[model samples]
Target: MNTNAEGHLARQQRVGTLIDLFAATVEEHGARPAVSDESVTLTYAELWAKTEQVASGLRAFGVGQGDRVAIHLERGVDLLVAVLAVVRTGSAYVAIDVGYPEQRRVHMVHSARATVVVTDTAAQDSPWDEKLVTTTVGDLTEATADATPVVAPVAAADPASILFTSGTTGRPKGVELTHGGLVNFATNAALPRILPTDRMGQVSSVSFDAFHYELWCAIAAGAEVVVMPSVPELLGRDPRRELKRRGITTMLMPSMAVNHLAKEDRDAFAALRVLCTGGDVILPQACREILDGQFSGEFYNLYGPTEGTTACTAHRVTADLDAAQPVPIGVPLDGCRVHLLDADLQPVPAGGTGQIFIGGAGVARGYLDEPAETAARFVDIPCGSSWGRLYATGDLGRLRPDGLLEFLGRSDQQGKIRGYRVEPFELERTLRNCPLVEDAAVLVHGEGDGKQLAAFVELAEDGAPAAVRAYLSERLPDFLVPATLIKIEQIPATANGKRDNEALREILRDDLHRRERYQKPDSRTERYLADLFEELLGVEQVGTHDDFFALGGHSLLAFRMHRRITRDFGSGLQLQDVIRHSRLADLANALDADPTGRPIRA
Candidate 1:
C-alpha cells in the first residue's frame, strides 16, 4: 500500500456515528425499502420512527452515553430495532444470543457491565432482570408511543457494539468496536459499489461481528436490508425459494453455503447481483462452479477478524483463478494495510508465509476489559500518529507474486468449524461441566475438507453417546458441539505429561480407519445410495454406516446428494435432513420411510 492510498483510505472515515449515517440514508431513501424479514417490511422512514421510539424508552430506562446495553433476542425486526435504538442512545449495544447457555449469558451480562437490557418475550424470565433494568420491545414501543423522542449526543469514536467470541481461556472475550471503525467498513470496504436499490441479505448471527457488515453496510449505503428467515434458513436448505421470496440482490454468506448453492441449487441465486463469502476460506471448487456460467452474479471473497471490525480485504473471483493453488484472501481494504511479518517483526520475502498484521483505523480498540490480552495482540507498530498500533492476527498467510495474500492456517488450537470460531480450550472447559465427562480434551480433528471438533473423554462411568450429545446440545451452540465423541480410559499425554493433541488426533484417525470393514450395499436402494455417495464424495467405496460429512461430504456436496436422491428416488428430501442422516444407511432408511417435509429418524 502506498502513502497516498493510505491517506486517501484513512480520510474515507467521514461519518460522525452509525446513527447519523443511517439517519442520512433514511432522509434520502425515505419511502424506499430498508429492512425486512418474513413478518414485516420497514421503509427507511418507518425504521427511523421505530428506532427513535425505542431509543426514548431506552433513555427512560437509564441507558445513556458510554453505557453498554445488552440486546437478548433472536434475529428479527425487533432485534434490529433494539440494536439501532441502543446505539441511538449514545450507548454501545451487546448482541446476546438467546440460545446461549444461561451460564454464558449471565457471565456476559456481568462482564459487559450492561446498564440495561432490551429483550423480547422469549427472554422475559432470563437473568437480565437480576443484573440490570430490563425492557421489552413491545413495552418500549407502547411507552414511547406518546412521548417525544430525542437523539442522544454521540461522537464518532464512541463504542458502537460489543461482540463476544471464544477466547483462548475458558471464558468468552468481548470484542468492543467503535462507530468510527464500523463507519470505515460500511463506507470504504463493505458494499462500496452498492446501489440504493440493491438488497443485502442478513445471514450472520446478531452476535457475530459480521452482522455489523451485514446490516450497517447496506443501510449506510442506502440499500435495502433483507434478513434471513432464521438460522436454519441460512443452513443448507434450498435457497431458491428464500432468495426469490425476499428478492435478495446481495448476500454475505459462509463459503460452504455459497458452494452448496452453486453445486445443488444452481439457479437459486439468479436474483442475486453480489454474493460475498468469508468466515472460512472458500474452496476453489465453489469458485469454479459459480464461474462456469452457472450463476451470473459476482462472487466476492471477504477476509477479516473481529479485531478488524469485519472484513478488511475483498477479492472478486475470476474464471482464470487456479483451482490447485490456495485462494488468496484478496487485496487490503481501503485504509487498512496487511503486512506479512516474520517472528522478529521483519517482513518476509514474497511467497514466504508470516503472521498477518493488520494496521490502520480499521483495527478495533481492544478486547473489552482484557487489557493485557488486548495489548498482547494489538502491537505498537510505527505509524505516523501517536496511536501506532496493529492487530497481530494469529493467522499465517503469504503474499503471492500477484500481490494477493494466500491464507496458510491457524498457528494455535483455535479453528473454524463450519463458519463459527471454536476455541478448543473453551470447549474443553464446557465439556468438563458435563457429568458424563470426568476428563476431556478437544482438538481440531482434520484439515481443510474434513475439519471438525473431536472430543476425547474419560468417563466417570459408562455414558451413552446420545445422552452426552443431548447434554452438550443444551449447553453449547450446535457449532460448538463436537461432531464426534470418543470414550477412553485416559487422555494420552506427552513425555512431559502435557496432553498431546497430535496423539489424540492420531487416535481418532486410526480408530476411524479401523472401523469394521466397509459393509457392502445389499438391497437395490442401498446400492443406489452407495453409488451416489461414491460419485459425490469421489470415494472408491462408501459403507452404509459411513458418515457422509466424515467422508469429505460438506453441506454443498450433501445438497448435491440430496438433489440426486430426490430426483432418482422420487423423494423430497431436504439438505438439512441429509446432513442429519449423514451415513448411507441412515439416509437410505430416511428415503425409504418419509422423504417429504422433515424425515423421521429410524
Candidate 2:
C-alpha cells in the first residue's frame, strides 16, 4: 500500500471533486467520444457543452446545491448528459427507472422530495402529477440548446447523487453519495485497474448503483462508455458478440459476463482485458468457468452495498479455485478499512466469523431521510485502531490468516434447521455447480409449523428439471436436498436485476396449495386431477385432494392449470370451474354431475 503523503494528496486533490474532475476531463479529452449508443454519440466537448446547457436550464428551474432531481428515463446518451448536468448544477440526481411500478415511482418522488424530474415524452403519463416540477428529456434538450456554459462550484463533500436501492422488503431507501466519496472510489479503487484505451460495457440500468461506477470509471479514464440497450434477449443471450463488435475491453458486472462466457463459443471475449463481477455472490464455479473457459482477462470479485458508493473491497482472483472453501473478498481499496467485530463492536480474531464493518471516506452520508436506519448501520467505532465511523454491513465473514476477507452468508439469512445453521447461498452454489442447472434459488417454504426447504431451478439447454433435482440429491445430504424442485424457463429478476426472492416465494406458495388440493380428493376425479397437477405443477406425484397452494402454485400457474384442464377435459371445465373445484375430488364430482339431473333446491 503506497501511503506517501504527497502522492496520496495529489491523487485525492486531482480527482477530489466530481464537478471539477469532470470539467478537467472535458478539457483534457475534448474531442474524444464520451458516450455512445445506437442513436447518438457525444464527444467530450459536446457532452460538456450539453451538460452546461442542461445545468443552466436546471438552475433556471430553481435546482441548486442539495436539491434532488429525480430522473425517470430509459438508458440513453441523453440520460448520461442529464445526470452530469444535474451534478454540474450542484443538485443531486436521483435515478428512477421508467419500468418501475407507478406506486414505487410515486413513493420515490415523495421520499426524495424532488424539485424537478427529467423524463421522456413517452413517460408523460407517469403518475408524477404536480408533485414536482417536470421537464421532459426533449424539453431539456431544446431548452439547453442555446444556454451559456458556466462551471458551478461544488465542494468535495457536497452530495453528488442519491440512488435508491431495490426495495425487496419494503420501499426503496435512498443512498446519498458525496462527490468526494464517489470520485475517490472511482479514481483510486476502480480506475487504476482500467486502461485508458479500454472500451467498457455499460449493461446495468442507470437506476442501479453499479451504473455510477461504470459511467464514472469510463469518463474519468477517458475510455469509451458503450451503452448497451436493455433488450429481453440481450439479458438471456451471449453479450460477448455485441461486446466484441464494439471492442469492449472491460465489463463491470458478472451476470452478463458470466452468461456470455458460459456459451459454447468462448472465443468471443478474446479481446477482453479486464472483467469485474459482483452485485451478488460470485459462485466459485462461475469464477472458475470464466478463468478457464472464456476470459483470459484480469478478474476481480467486488463487494459493497449501495451506501458504500458502488464497492469497498475488491479481490483479484487468482488461479487457485479449489484451495479455499469460500473465495476471499480480498483487501480493502485505498483509503478504506474492513473490520470484523462482535455484537459489542470488539474486533474478533482473524479465523472467527463476525459481522463485517466498513469505514472510511468511501462510506456515504447515510440513507436519505432514513435517519433511524442510517444511525443503526453507521456507528462510531471508538475501540478500533483509531477514530472513524463504521457501517455494520449485516454480512458475516472472517478474515483469513493472510488478511484477505472471506465472505460468509448474510447474518439475517442464516437460519437454524434441525439444530444446524443453514446458509441458502451455500445450497444455491452447490445447485448451480450441477451441469444441467442454469440457475437456482432456494427458499424456506411451508407455514411455521411445517416449514421445509424448496428449490426453484431453471435448467440449462437440453436439461430436465428431474435430472437437476436428482443430481443435487446425489451431491447434497438428505436434509440439504430440496424437498421439492420446481423448474421454470427463466428466473425472474427485479428492475435492478437481483434475483426476485419475493416473486419466487409467491410461486412456491402456489405450488404448496396446488399440492394440498391434489392430496384431499373425495371422488374418482382424483385420476384427472393427478394428470393435470403433474402437468401444471411439473411434478410427478400429486394426490387427488392436494391443495394448489401446497403445490407452490401461483397465479400464473393457476392460469396455466385452468387452460390445461379446460384443454384436456374439453368444455367440461371453465375458468370458473377450476376456481370453484380447486380440489381434485371437487372437480371430479362436478364432472360426474349429469346434465339431465334435476337442480338441487338452493
TM-score of each: 0.91, 0.70
Instruction: List lDDT for all candidates, in order.
Output: 0.78, 0.70
Question: Residue-wise lDDT of candidate 2 within 249-318, one digit each (tens)?
Answer: 8877643334333433345455679877666555566566667765678878788777778878888876
Question: Backbone clashes in each candidate structure, one number apiece?
Answer: 0, 35
Deviation of model 2 at 343, angstroms: 1.1
Clashing pairs in 1: none
- Scored by TM-score, the top model is 1
Task: After superposing candidate 1 on the true structure, give the runs of residues whose Cα lies further than 4 Å from its correct spot.
Answer: 2-13, 99-102, 189-192, 234-236, 383-387, 531-542, 545-560, 573-586, 593-602
What is the C-alpha lDDT profile of model 1 across 1-602, one tens digit per residue? 42225544554544657887888888889999888877898999999999899899888887899899988887788888888889899999999877677877888887899988788776667765475787798899898897787667887777998888886766788888888888878877433467898988887777777788778888777888887854345545557777777788887777656655666655666678887888887889778777775567787888998889888787888888798876788888877778887888777877898988887767888899998989899898653334457898888998878877788888766898777778988878988888888989987766664577888888777676568778887777777777678888899989999888788878887767664478887666778888888787666567788887656566556667777777676677667778888878887788878735333222
lDDT for position 1 in model 1: 42
Name the 10 consecutive residues with the lowest summed lDDT in model 2: 593-602
